[model samples]
Target: MAITKEEVLHVARLARLELNDAEVERFQGQLSAILEAVGKVAELDLSDVPPTSHPLEVSNAWGEDVPHTSLTQDEAFANAPERDDDHFRVPPA
Candidate 1:
């Protein structure tokens, strides 16, 4: 899992990044460490563990949907800067 300087340079080129020699060397070590850590994770024993979609239980907290009274058109449009017969108007973008 050791990342080489050439591989770092190639990755930077593919990503359209301009890195100096120091940055290339730095990223080489950092990327190599990340890959090594991931490799260690692959060595874990989880044969008996059941796969789960989520780590925690999930449920909706919303109340039941219900209809209610609403403001009239004039009341709703009272604060509008501009309006047509029954709708607000805005300039074209």
Candidate 2:
């Protein structure tokens, strides 16, 4: 569908934008052309085309997780900047 100047103005209003008469006319043409391009693309035969989010295969850099020995409480607390026996101490709230 062709986008009218009024439709452009309405969209501008919805977006809280201020457009002059010339700007509205320009946007009406630009947005209409975009719709026309999309419409043309929609007319293409693509029944065999598969839906894909990305053309390339994607994967996480980190590998599968495995159980491993973790640090003990003493080792974890050895490097604390501020600590109270078994817990971190912060400034008064």
Candidate 3:
């Protein structure tokens, strides 16, 4: 699972990254560690475990769908500073 310096350089090249010798060496170690951790996880036995998108139970809480009377056009425009007939007037963008 260990990553090579050449592989790290190749990945950097594909990503259009310009890495110096120090950065390449550092990334090589970091990426190799990540691969080693994933390898350890792959060695685990979880036959009884079930696959799930979320760890906790999920449910949707919806409000009651009730009809209600809305405001009239004149009532809605009562506090407007400016009005263009039935629409509110605004400065040009």
Candidate 4:
């Protein structure tokens, strides 16, 4: 989990970053600590835990689908600035 100075510089190069000596040293320690913290997960006993996409139980909150009365063609075209019979008219692409 100990990130090397060379690894830090390599990462900075990949990210198109120009890190000074101080920044490189700082990031090296920070990245090492982060990796050590993340490595703790491997030590956990997760055999009894089920694999899930989400940590919490979730369900779709959708309302019942029902048919309803719709506007007529005349009503739909009433506010149109330009119309072409049954469709709204638009400028040619």
Candidate 5:
């Protein structure tokens, strides 16, 4: 379907845009072509197609989590800009 210049002007107004006559005419044609392309997509038959979030099949490649040695509290806070004996300090929210 063809889009009109008034429709383009109305959309420009809704978006708080200032379009001259030339821009309005240009957008009228461009938006009409876009609507026609989308209309063509709407005419397709896809009754057997399944909706998908991704176009390709996907699977997790990560291995199982393993336990490991961890840093002590003192080591963790060694580089703190402001810290108490047992914890880091921050400005009150």
Candidate 6:
């Protein structure tokens, strides 16, 4: 399918883009080529193909969940630039 200059202008206007005459002409050709390629893909016969979410078969690759000891309050706040009692202090937002 060919994309018209008017359609490109309309889309640019909807997107709040200010395209010059040259840009509009350039995008019209580029978009038309992209649409033509997509149309070619749509014309392919894929009746026997199954819809796949991924190109490769991927199973859960996560490691076993194991509980571990976390840093203590004092240890966690040791590198804080500013601290009050036991917590790190931050500048007012």
- Candidate RMSDs in order: 9.5, 11.1, 11.4, 11.1, 10.3, 8.5
Task: List per-prediction Cα lDDT, in the order shown.
Answer: 0.90, 0.87, 0.90, 0.92, 0.88, 0.91
| Candidate 1: clashing pairs of residues | none
lDDT of 4 by residue, 1-93 (tens): 899999999999999999999999999999999999989987999899776777667788677899789999999999998999999998996
Q: What is the lDDT of candidate 2?
A: 0.87
| Residue lDDT tens for model 2, 1-93 | 699888999999999999999999899889999999889967889889886777778866486689889988789888887889878777886
TM-score of each: 0.47, 0.48, 0.47, 0.49, 0.48, 0.49
- For residue 69, model 3's alpha carbon misses the true position, in angstroms, by 29
- Cα deviation of 63 in candidate 4 (Å)? 20
Q: Which structure among the candidates has the greatest lDDT?
A: 4
Candidate 2: which pairs clash? none
Cα shift from native, residue 54, model 1 (Å): 9.7
Off by over 4 Å in 1: 45-93
Instruction: State the displacement of the C-alpha of residue 14, model 5, in Å, after optimal TM-score superposition.
Output: 0.7
Misplaced by over 4 Å in model 3 are 46-93
Q: Flag the better candidate by TM-score, 3 or 5.
A: 5
Count of backbone collisions within predicted model 1: 0
Residue range with the least summed lDDT across 10 consecutive positions in model 1: 52-61
Candidate 5: clashing pairs of residues: none
Per-residue accuracy of model 1 over 4-91 as CA lDDT, tens digit each: 9999999999999999999998999999999999889669897887877677777665777897899999998999989898998878
lDDT preference between candidates 1 and 6, better one: 6
Residue-by-residue lDDT tens digits, candidate 5, 57-76: 87675777997889998888
The local lDDT score (0 to 100) that residue 77 gets in candidate 2 is: 80
User: 3 or 6, which is superior by lDDT?
Assistant: 6
Two-way lDDT contest, 2 vs 4, winner:
4
Rank by lDDT (best first): 4, 6, 3, 1, 5, 2
